[model samples]
Target: MFDQLIAYLDSVRARDPAPRSRWEILLYPGVWALGFHRLAHWLFDGELYFLARFVNHLSRWLTAIDIHPGAKIGRNLFIDHGFTVIGETAEIGDNVTIYQCVTLGGTNPTNGVGGKRHPTLKDNVIIGSGAQIIGPIVVGERARVGANAVVTDDVPEGATMIGLKARSTLVPAETWLREFIPYGTPCDEPCEQGNGGVERVEALERELAELRAEVAALKEERQVPARSRKTGAAS
Candidate 1:
């Protein structure tokens, strides 16, 4: 029992809002996170929905962290510093990484008595900053949600999503950073479309390839042409 407490404390210190020494993290984070989750879970289980919401709201206001009471989060889930939110009825697997301003909410703003309403995040999922994952969708294991992405559909295992509307990108699963707290970076070459440079690059490559083929055909035509022998003139 004592050993578990010590370990939980260590994890908290390491992943809490404040950056502390190794020893400080080893002792603080566990206690804070545990306390927060316990209250949240307790309120969720209770029938007092209004009071539960009120408590959750107060907690978020005071801590800049908001988790709906009905959300089911597994053990050792680290909440890194930033604006964090969890939707009611959201089911999170163990060992998830959530950065600031991330939402795990349902699309239905009005409450319903349905089971498949909120997002279900599988184990080891990494959610980036300012990302909005709304609706009833499942984010598969080890899936990575990129910064400022608005996701509404289901994500497959090891998938990486990016952009406003949220499209899967070529970023590999291994390269995903667990704690991705994004800040605004000026775009050196923002695309005409919202997909940064991906769409533009593809278009340019296609055009260049066509141009090269056309040039080669023109050169071949200029070089050697069949002349009609009967015409007695270069055709």
Candidate 2:
């Protein structure tokens, strides 16, 4: 227990620029969530499922970070900021850094009774704020997911992923670790689409949807007339 506390403190001190003291670290959401998670995970492993859930609920209420008791999380996991969610079947490895509003969620909500639904993030992976890693995909060690990106496919080790489509560019994990990119990518890199560009695309998409609806209505109208003509011929 003493070692775990020290490790958690050390991890927070090393990763975060905010908290000045160990006392401050204790007040952080990540520390509180992880502290409760340890006890909850122990209860869950012992098959005390209801008790585990009760503990988890309390933790969520207090921290606003929801990490399921069933999730397999390793040491030095840093949940930066709050509102981070780690799903029931999600597997997280050691030294993972997750920013606020990140979700390691399940893609298929229905049909499957019990199986791995969420993603598996290997050691040293960094998930930026608002990133959603859905499905049973594997994010290999030292991979990075950019903010607001939605990743559906598996990410290779040392890869840097970005955008809504989750495009990846590979870099050696060692080299990536040596230099840190604050928001998962350098500031100089151009955005895939600016706000104006996005708005224009959205407008075009709406127009396209209206056109498709109009075409569908025409097709239905033509089919109805054909059926009526056949009925008249038979009569």
Which candidate achieves the best TM-score against the true structure?
Answer: 2
lDDT of 2 by residue, 1-235 (tens): 8888888798778878788888898888988998899899999999999999999999999999999999989988888889999998999999888989999998765876869999999988889999999999999997889999999999998788999989996655455765345546544333465586688679999999999999999999999999999999999
How many collisions per candidate?
8, 0
lDDT of 1 by residue, 8-61 (tens): 556545445465565655443333543566686786687777777777766676
Model 1 segments more than 4 A misplaced: 9-34, 109-114, 172-235
The pairs that clash in candidate 2 are none
Show the lowest summed lDDT stretch of 10 residues, model 2.
182-191
For candidate 2, what is the TM-score? 0.75
Off by over 4 Å in 2: 170-175, 179-181, 189-235
